[model samples]
Target: MGVTYRRILLKLSGEALMGELSYGVDPAVVHGIAEEVAELVNEGIEVAIVVGGGNIFRGMMGAAAGMERATADYIGMIATVMNAMTLQDALERIGIPTRVQTAIAMQEVAEPYIRRRAIRHLEKGRVVVFGAGSGNPFFTTDTTASLRAAEINAEVLFKATKVDGVYDSDPKKNPDAKRFKSLTYSHVLQQDLKVMDSTAIALCKDNDIPIIVFDLSVRGNIKRAVAGESIGTIVGGFCEVC
Candidate 1:
């Protein structure tokens, strides 16, 4: 089968790394994900990932308790580094050459954020995992995924979340929440749907890259998304205008 995406950016939430256990990285869960990613590599798709830090450090939680926002965000960034390292270890164990690039400049552990080097890694078929949420406070990892996708010139941004697609309401909390098979960014914005933070959708719209929202829990979903089967809500592209 022909590869649908030459290159794709996957946004994995830190919560995705948590498996059966309550907190932290679950090795089995991560290894399973790495194996699935390896299959995509074997299929010749260039993959870069941006992972969230909510599983380890919820900056919003700290801020809600009246802590300084910037300091809490820095802690959150460090949490992402920890998650990236764990995922890097799992990927390497399975023979995938992966690089963890952090925006916060942790030179001893991983490469600092450099767009040229990152693009070069993708060209060379290495998985570049971006961590640290754009190295700025008040920016969510969703926005980071869009930024990195644009910087790397990836064709699409694949956001992996607990939900299968953007819904009219929280499916977990609302039994009657309707799942959107597809959605345009304009409709998402006009209706004030929580598909993503406004900043993320705006960046993708400006850059002309689409975002695919899918449930990461479903087995082989990532591969399916990269292979161009309509697995989730597609936003911010030509089809959206159509």
Candidate 2:
């Protein structure tokens, strides 16, 4: 099979790491992700990841409860680091070389985020896991994914979520909800589709990077999507299967 993207960025949510569990990282899910990533590495793909911290902590939730915005965001960033470490351990257990990097200074546990160093790590066939959402408040991990993807010149960004793909409406509630096969960045932004945040979408649009959104619950979906099997909705470009 021809690989559609040789260099890709995988954007994983902390909640995505929580499979069936109410909160916190699920070992099985992490292991599954690591396996998929390993498959890609074996195929000679350069993969990078930016994980969210929603499973462990949500800055918005803390802010709703009256905590200082910046403080809550910083705490949430730390939560991402925890998730990243767990993922790194899972990958390394299976003989995959991995690196955990953070935006904020945490030299004891992870390397500080350096664009050149990260690119070199990818070139060396190591999976780089980026944690901490931009090291600033009011920025989401989605934005971080887009920013990092652009920085690394990734060919595409893959978003693995619980849902199968971006729907016109909540598929669970609306039986007739529509799932798009392909959409332009303008369409996603104009409709406010839940593919990603507006800023993230805009960043990708500016960089002309395509995004593949698929369900993480299904094993092998990552590899299938990477092989251009078209198992999900694609934004910013034509569907690979099409």
Candidate 3:
């Protein structure tokens, strides 16, 4: 079967790694995700991931609690690095070649993020995991995913979320919420859907990159999304929900 996208940047929230736990990563969840990603790599798909740090520590929450915003954000970035390492370990245990690149220089643990080097790693069939959230304060991991996707010229940006797709309202809170199969960048911005931050959405819109928001909790969903099986809400491009 033919795949829909040749290369993609997958965005995973730290919470996704938490599984049923209230905090920290669940080994079972990480292993499961690694298996799925390994399957994609084996299928000849170029996959790069940008993981979030909300499970370990959220910068915003720290700042609200009186920590300096920059300090809090830096801590959050370190948390992402930790998650990246954990994911790398899982992928390697399954014999999937992987690299951990961080926006911040952590030579002892991960290589400093280099666009050219990252692309080269992908060309070599190694899954590149980008960590540290752009190495900047006040920027979300979503923005990091968008920027990296454009840099790598990925065909699509896959936002792996807990939800099945983007909805008109919170699906968890409102059972009657309508899920959108497709939407325009403008509609997402105007409606404030919270699918991705405004900066991340704008970056994708500017680069003309398509964003697919799908449920990552479901096993095999990632592969289905990569195969263009119409499993989630696709944003950007000419598609519009009327």
Candidate 4:
């Protein structure tokens, strides 16, 4: 079947790349993700990804450890670039055309981010992977994903996570916590649900972009999400059918 959304920006946390490991990227995990993304591209869906670096280094953690805030954030950005490069390599190995665009200029590794160029890349059917978290300090990759999704005019933002969907309480902690099939941006912010940062949620709300929080651990979840299967929490807009 055809996908419901034409173009989508997938937000992947660095921790998602670590499969059965405490930290660091697992080659097999990266390859699996690449395979999923490749399937989307083959189905004629334009795909872009914004990856986080929490598994390698978290800026907030470093700041708490007495490091300079800006310096620590920069380090975190660099770590994201590394993850992006690793993902790019994996996608290319499987014969998927991909490009790594960094917010911070890294001429030797990837191209510097350019808005028009990124849109053009997607038009040409290349999966553009954005790295470096907006090239600024004090901003999380969640915000970067939101910003990029808007800039690229993506139809939806897929926030991949371990949980199947957003719950009133942590499902791991509260077995009775109800999962939301669909929610409004106002509800998420008012309840302080940890689906995405406030900034990211607000951005998507303003842009009228729908955010789907789904379980990435499931093998075919990505495809299901792109296909508009009701397998996760849909935020920003409510649909009776969803």
Please report, in order, the local distance difference test score of every candidate based on alpha carbons.
Answer: 0.88, 0.93, 0.95, 0.94
Model 3 ranges with Cα > 4 A deviation: 238-242
Write down the TM-score of every candidate: 0.95, 0.97, 0.98, 0.97
Compose the digit string of candidate 4's lDDT tens values, residues 131-183.
99999999999999999999999999999988899988888899899888999
* The candidate that achieves the highest TM-score relative to the unseen native structure: 3
Top lDDT prediction, candidate number? 3
Writing each residue's lDDT as its tens digit, candidate 2 over 133-155 gives 79999899999999999999999
Q: Candidate 3, residues 13-32: lDDT per residue as tens digits?
A: 99999998999999999999
User: How would the candidate models be sorted by lDDT, starting from the highest?
Assistant: 3, 4, 2, 1
Candidate 1 lDDT (Cα, 0 to 1): 0.88
Badly placed stretches (over 4 Å) of model 4 are 239-242
lDDT of 1 by residue, 20-127 (tens): 678888888899899989898877889999999988998889899999989899899899989988888888888989999999989999999999999999888889
- The Cα error of candidate 3 at residue 41, in Å, is 0.7
Ten residues in sequence with the least summed lDDT for candidate 1? 233-242
